[model samples]
Target: MIKKAVIPAAGFGTRFLPATKAVPKEMLPIVDKPNLQYIIEEAINSGIEDIIIVTGRNKKAMEDHFDRSVELELLLEKTNKHELLNTVEQISNLVDIHYVRQKEPLGLGHAILCTKKFIGNEPFAVLLPDDIIDNEEPALKQMVNHYNDVQSSILGVKEVPHNDVDKYGIVEIEKSSTSLYPIKGVVEKPAVDVAPSNLAIVGRYILTPEIFDKLENVKPDAKGEIQLTDAIESLRFDQSIYACALEGTRYDVGDKFGFLQATFDFAMKREELHEPLKKYLKEKLEE
Candidate 1:
């Protein structure tokens, strides 16, 4: 069983600029909750009992966000804000969450490698906070279910426009009729014409303990950062790795436009904001 999950959030989100200068990108708010919280909730919903968040310097805020805040709780209690108090308490007691410092912003692969000691010798799931997937069946849960059936590594994949193939790690898959495709290999940000397939790897993965060895052996790319895709490609040579087409609407909250879209979409779902937000948008569009 995949009881442990890792969230590699050590990256300095330079894309978000001044806002991210002092704040970890993972801690950025989506609606009322931090982006990382959604990913953690998804893991818990997927049956993961423990989570190790790989963090870095200046990421203390992320840790504090999950930790208890007695002062704030007392304030909320004193104000009789029971709803807000319960929400705060629930976040602190969500799951058995732990943290490990990545020490440097080497790369996603390196961040994940830092969690080896906590993972020990077991299969685990990796979820990227950037990809906030909204679905009836949580994206991570779908991957977890697939992992249980195959007993092998699973990569959450989604088809992308051919023109955008260069934006993602494209997977080469053997022809399959089902949503699950047998991954032949993975190419990181290949040119559109050269991309093996339109299926791009998103932020979710269920990998075996053997991947740690592959990650350690992977040479850094030209940027001197180890890439998880490169390690996964190498691991594919040793074991079967399948890409499961995740059924969901994925919002790439790491990008500016995507973040806005997620914010708007999430706002539209809230009962208090739905009609007013819709009316506002409709009026703006008619302007």
Candidate 2:
């Protein structure tokens, strides 16, 4: 069973700029909760017992958010804010979370490699907090279910516009009728004309321990950073990898526009904000 998950949040969040100068991008708020919280909740709901978060400098806030704030809790208790207190306590008790420093801002593949010790010899899940998936079933859970059936590594994939294939790790697949595709290989940010398929690998992954070996041997690209897609493709030569087309809406919250869309969508789902927010948007559109 995949009981452990890794979250590689050591990035500099250069895109978010000045706002991210002091704050970890993963700690940026989406609605009332930090973005990383949503990912952790998904992991916990998906039966993940332990999580190793790969962090870098200025990411201490992310760590503190999950840790217990005793003085704050006591103040909340004294103020008789029972509901707020419960929420705070729940965040702290969510799961068994561990942290490992990546030290340098390598790349996604290197960040994940930092968690090898925590993962030991078992299969594990890797979730990128940038992609917030909204679905009836948690995205990682869906991948886990597929992993159970196939007993192989799984990558959460979704079809993207052919023009957008260059923006993602495109997978070459053996055609199949079901949502699951038998992955032939994966190319990282291939050119539009050269992309094998429009099936783009998303942030959720169920990877085997064997991947660690592949990652270790993967030569850095011209950019001097290891790409996880390269490691996964190398692993494919040894064992099969399958891509499961996840059922849900994926918000690339790492992007500015995508983050705004997620914020608006999540706000519209809240009972207190739904009606008024809907009315306000309608009026703005009519203008």
Instruction: Give the alpha carbon lDDT tens digit for every residue of 182-214 in model 2.
Output: 999899999999999999988999999999999
Clashing pairs in 1: none
Which residue pairs collide, candidate 2? Answer: none
Candidate 2 regions exceeding 4 Å error are: none
Off by over 4 Å in 1: none
Worst 10 residues of 1 by lDDT: 140-149
lDDT of each: 0.93, 0.94
Cα lDDT for residue 31, candidate 1 = 83
Clashes (N, CA, C under 3 Å) per candidate:
0, 0
| TM-score for all models, in order of appearance | 0.98, 0.98
Local accuracy of candidate 1 as per-residue lDDT tens digits, 1-287 = 99999998888899998999999999899888899998999999999999999988899998899899999999999999999999999999999999999987788899999999999999999999999999989998998888888899999999999999999999999988888889998999999999999999899999999999999999999988989999999999899999999999999999999999999999999999999999998999999
